[model samples]
Target chain A: MPSPTSKPRGILPAALFAVVTAVVVVLGIWQPFEPGGGDLEIAGGGDPVRGEALFAESCAGCHGEGGVGGGGGPSLVDSPIDEETATRTVLAGRGTMPAGILGGTDAVDVGSYVVQISGAVEGAVPPVAEEPPLGPAGEVQLTGPRLWGIFVSLAQPAGATWTIWLDGGAQDALRVGEIPAGQTTFADPDLGIGTIIDQYNRVIIGEQLQDFALATDELSEARITALKALIIGEGNPPGANSLVSVAGEQFAVFSDHTRFLVEARDEANLANIRFHSEHLVNIALGAPIADVDQNGEPTNPGDGVGLLGQDGREGYLPQIDAAAGVGTIAPLAELVPAVEATVADARVCGDIASVEAAGPCVNAIEARSAKLDQLWGQVPDAARASAVLALERP
Target chain B: MSVNVFVADVSSGYADLMETVFTSAIVGKAWLATAAIVLALVQLLSAGRIYGKLGSARILSSRAAATVHRWSGRLAFLFTLPIVFHCVTILGFQTTDTRVAVHSVIGSVFYGAFAAKVLFVRDHRYPGWVLPVAGGTLAALLAVAWLSSSYWYFTEVRFGF
Candidate 1:
């Protein structure tokens, strides 16, 4: 046997293994150090003073000054609504209140202001029921004013029916009969727009909750569960309720169809292409196309909400004249064939294998390009120049 | 493909939790960096002791030193898993700024260097310089990653959570 002074055989490896295993096990069981309580700090800290100003401008009309009860809106001061609920309520609107017009930072600021001034009790808003808010998987019931807002904004003729062209050339005609004066389930739950609207609503809810959690320096389990539910859209049909389905669809189409079509002519003219195509689509949708003033600012704002409006104006407009003063260009329907022909020629050029075949492809591309140029050229120089100038302006 | 999807889902699932658990985004990263640096020092010192280059065989037996080095290295690697997961799944590989670009490149290389070091340690048939080179590269990459992220966070951004 070896002397006692000599290290035991295999002890080093055994000891090392034990130590590593123990560390792993301890780490697995040990709770990560959470910066809860006083240790937590909100990222990009909020200013309640600035938030107060924003709230007065955007919210006081309905909520009254100092968030006291007034004018069809409930009392916001000492309101039981938590920060999360208040933010979501402001963003999506509830009951008679319209959806908040404020963007991200402004929304957060207003929310912070409301929380500060109102002394809103935390965790006051009741938990959402376990059941999915939008109904079952394939059949999601789209109810509430937010969905109505989206429907009204995107409706084909601002009344009657909405038409959506799907990815495989299937056209869906949804009869939106009347804008619901109150919360009502949509008759057609299977429409893709309903699904998109639902997803958007959930995202808004989740984001507000996240903001609340950050502001409070506490990510409660309830908040996490709610956020996860909203994000995952657990009960929705596979791929329908996810952000990947809604926003992803928009992005993919914009990239593959719109970008591809525009880039075919001249890759360097993306800014001009974006301006023209977006406005063209806006015009097609029967929304107002704004006229630029001498300073290149949109003079006559189109009456449409969100990014769909060409004029970069916010709020609702009853009727938008597509061709007020602009000279006669071909109708949007007439322009589609030209755009398609150009795209087809570009594709053909991409597929050509022979050097000799390149001549005809070039000629075909040039002809289609000229056709589009002539078609777009019919519109008055003022309108086109205004759009170009607006695009270039900060 | 399924595996990739699964990994992505799991990574995404923990992203919010990770963000919440950390002190502040910047400070939490600094803590992780400090831990990694300390472990790296332990690894280097133990490695030196194992090679008998520290001039004190009495301090720790070669086998004991090797064991310490191995475990310290493993611990360091374990510390990086969550950071890597967050970076890959949530942040993706973005080069929007100079700082982010350098961090992204270093983070990408750190994993490869780690793999090389682990392999070299196990396989003795390689040239003697291989293990040292691999270890040194991993250390260097980790240092750069720490500097670009945590260092920048502390110096430029506030130190508090």
Candidate 2:
């Protein structure tokens, strides 16, 4: 009964099918396309939970439960580096970096998992906002033996608790206090010098004073001196100080004290390192005090003045972030001769204070350095890769 | 109630409501619920306009409409009873929030009015008194739900939700 012009029922069905097909084709052309980055099946699918356990075992000694570094390592949480970059850095050792901590399928899986969990990759060191002068900062009143322990754990809750107040001078003043987790507190009084903590455990101000310290006005000079001393002592010292001797260059014994000097390198680096170390110290033994340990109390040693007796504490020891990485501190006794030689060389040739000129001394020590390579050789590929990432150029 | 208890109740009640809405089964019985809600709305609206005219010409003259409205309302209310019970026992009792109590009160009232409508219609007498009761109860129930739901939606949904 179909009309001649309409054709038979079969034709009607075909026409309808043709129309639907045309619509689908048009839609396919008009819709936005997403090109596949490819299903890159890595050897092992990095299990976040396993990675977490591994992090606690091997990495936690430096990187915390949250991927933030303590002691020798730098923070890995919220790192800005992409997964690919992080993977590559972890695989290949860089300056002062150990090779192959995370290699093989396990390394790939762990690195991939870390990249997945760390939201935003960051530079070598987290940048600090301009802080105002807070008078004498880094002053901790450690009376009880347990006070040091409490201070060590202060920043563990996460986020930034310490803030900087500018005194309109070369040395920036930082106010150490407690802030709630996951909130940001500004330094401005009107804005409430203290606010809340953020996703990074960086509270504006509140809770216990996570250990803080002051930077010398001559920050660069201090860093250069410290680096020179460390390099000569640990990098290429002579005789009994030698941890390892390659060719003719000799390395020195590493100690907590030596690492402290290198930790206090730059203003920003110093703050982060100090904050990290304090958290570690708090976690380990409670607080950093003189009588509490060999360092002597803040009150003792002429009311805690001068370098040895300074009232403020030193190092963010507990925060072992692999990114910032830890430098093996060569003992001063073994390194004195090399340091003296470098000093003599610098005095004879370039300015001792010039950080730029100090490079040669650091390099000479590095050239003779053997402990790092030895350590790198002992660890698995994944660990070596992570160590490499730690030493990568900022 | 104490200030703490009051706040807890309000928060718990809101959470309970959300859980019910999200997890409810809308399949199979959708028609029954939809029909009841529609009839209840119409009856409530018509009653409001009439100023308490239940057995008046407007309703009595529309037998088909009245039957549909009456039957649908009763069936929906009957269906809602089990859902209410499940929600109360599962989500309501589990939380300390007082809002659960408020929800229970409103839901009970809704069922009460609905039951009265079913009874009135069953007896074949319009039961002039039952119409106002149903209408008033529906209005109160709607007010509570609308206010609470609207406030919660505005606060959470307007920005993030």
Candidate 3:
């Protein structure tokens, strides 16, 4: 070997090279970004008040009293879809469930509702279950009239009860027993409409059951009398249930030709459900009577009760006519003019906020209109003639 | 007669002999095939005389390299002849019926052009043009083969992208 050389390889350069090599190795190993995966924001918390309402209306029926599934649905209180995963599950669809469970604007509404009551997230747990109702469960006599008032508050009807007071009229002393806790008591003409009071006194509208309500006009009286007959237990032997069938087009199809269709949102298909679930709540308590909507078809004929006429007979199915039933939607018609005028005003004014307000207002009015139309439609002609006969005799 | 003499004279049996000679040449001279292309490029630089402007004698020595390059390119065509026969017999390009008729014709044209390039090398003052044309034709043929096979003749159908 030549004389031992004394030249520096420079510690700094070597260290720099080592650092760069380390960086490259780390970069290769830890590929931080992956292609093809999509991005989604997780659900934050939601309003408990809104959550409670949604639970009562949508989730409570299937998932038992507190997100515990009863007969038909799986309990969700400690389910797989925790907050982060719940958002993902809803967006992507789980096992057999399809997407958009509650589509349109209600999608957000319903999704927030599910996350709130699911108890998988913090800050939205259920209230401690209360002790069974204080009074004896046996002597708890919940009459039709008593049930109706409790249902109204529990239902959270769109406007205030006073609004109903202005429209439906008031009545006097009525006895209601066997009420559930957190329920309202019943009085004659619980709502304050004039005809409602008259009908209560006259007994044309009997001790109102949860299913029955006082219609605002004579036409409605005729319709309800006829419809009450076809219901399963109506005037039939004790314990008889009604059987009805309605059909509609299929919604989705897969490669195996298995198609998916639904009778309602936030409600399970009737075939795979139990009576004490949220789905039952929707069917028995939440569903409105099926009626011809602006599309001139029953808003939900596939799942809704068939309409009857004023004469104690089933109503004739009429073709949708824009003009004929335009303002004559017996129970729901009053809101139509305001809605129509709103649409016309939006056309004239052309301001976006005004238009936005107009659209929802129109939609709300339309839904009401559809309900009244359906109720009036059920009134049989014979009932109309009978009422006329009853009036003429006096 | 010697095999080379018979091939040079184009005798009746020479075509069969040519096939044998060319096949063996391809196996042994595959490396030469790569070298031949390099030599051709060197010859081009010399003929262009840019090296001569630099006053290097290396440019003057490119004549043999030019002759060999021309001969090797022509030999490549002979090597390709067996490929066609192999494709037809083993790959089944030719028979009573086949769909790749277009492929077969394009392949024949490619090989034929390669042979012509070698034969015509001595005639033109600037013979490099043939090399480029042959290269372009070979590339196009490869592209066609790859695309048709990769896309399955464009038969894969679906709803959207």
lDDT of each: 0.42, 0.33, 0.30
Give me the displacement of residue A226 in model 1, in angstroms: 63
Candidate 1 segments whose C-alpha is farther than 4 A from its true place: A1-394, B1-16, B19-21, B56-58
- What would the TM-score be for candidate 3 when compared with the true structure? 0.18
Q: What is the clash count of model 2?
A: 89
Q: Which pairs of residues clash in candidate 1, taking residues 3 or more apart in a chain or in different chains?
A: none
How far out, in Å, is residue B159 in model 3? 23
TM-score for chain A as predicted in candidate 3: 0.22
Which one is best on lDDT?
Answer: 1
State the local distance difference test value for candidate 3. Answer: 0.30
Expressed as tens digits, the lDDT of each residue in A1-394 for candidate 1 is 3444554333433354455434433332231221111222344323456667766655653454556533225567665444554544544345434332342334445666667666653543322224322210111222221122222111111111111211211233232333222222224324445433322322110101111110011223443333223222346463354222332233233234343434433554433333434433332222453321112432211222311222444211111113211222233234445545544453454344443443454455455555554543432221211111000000
Q: Report the lDDT tens digits of candidate 2 across residue range A1-394.
A: 3333542232433354355434433333332110101222334334455545444543443343455543234567676555544544443323222222333333344455566556643333332213321121121111111111112122123232333222223333334443344433222222232211100111112112112121112123333233222212233222112111111121112223224323433332433332323322222222333222222222111111111111244211111111113433223223334333432332222222344444453344333234333432232222112211010101
Predict model 2's lDDT versus the native.
0.33
- The Cα RMSD of model 1 versus the native structure comes to 25.9
Sorted on TM-score, best first, the list reads 1, 2, 3
Q: Per-residue lDDT of A248-330 in model 3, one digit per residue for the tens? A: 01000100011111111124332211111122111211135222112223222123321212233222222111111322324
lDDT of prediction 1: 0.42
